[model samples]
Target: MATLLLIEDDLMVRATLRQILERAGHVVIEADHGGEGLSKLEQQHIDLMITDIIMPEKEGIETIIEARRRHPQLPIMAISGGGRTRNMDFLEVARQAGADSTMAKPLRAQQLVDEIDQLLRA
Candidate 1:
């Protein structure tokens, strides 16, 4: 099983994602914001990262960029429910920032698991 870092500000959403990932056999490390997520990434061995786009302390796009710079080979999956801005999609921005994959919320558990599995394989 792979160790995953899950960065989400919403407590309920974080709990739900943790449950889903754990059930899928991944060891999940939870962080309420991107800064904490990056701290965890430095402290532990993380195979993949799943981060929400909007967060306090640090947003996902900036986090993705920094994380990518620090760990270029780390797989990142960004999730967002913020929808579109005047011109750009949050998920698309995430990809541009350095996320390996992106998903919109509310996320489907099986699909999430499948995507993580595929990322781990890659």
Candidate 2:
């Protein structure tokens, strides 16, 4: 089972993802925003990180960059929804920020798990 750190500002999204991942047999650690997520990264033994793009305090792109600075080998999955994004170039932005992969929001359970499996294989 992979140790996953999930960072999402929306409570409903965070809870849903947590349930899905835990049911899939992974250990999940949740953070409410990028800042808290970053702090958790400093303290937790995370195998992979799944983060949302928009959040208070710190953004996912910034979080990814900061995390990559300290943990280059770490795998990151960046996710974003349609409405709240100020920028249109999410995939490109995340790639530039050093994320291993990006997933669009409102994802299927299997899709999320499968992506994590794929990234781990790499």
TM-score of each: 0.95, 0.94
Encode model 2's per-residue lDDT on 31-121: one tens digit a residue.
9888999899999799899988877899889999999998899999999884455454785788889999988777888999999999987
Q: Listing every candidate in turn, what is its Cα RMSD in Å to the true structure after a full C-alpha superposition?
A: 1.8, 1.4
Off by over 4 Å in 2: 85-88
Model 1 segments more than 4 A misplaced: 83-88
Scored by lDDT, model 1 comes in at 0.93
lDDT value for model 2:
0.88
The all-Cα superposition gives candidate 2 an RMSD in Å to the true structure of 1.4
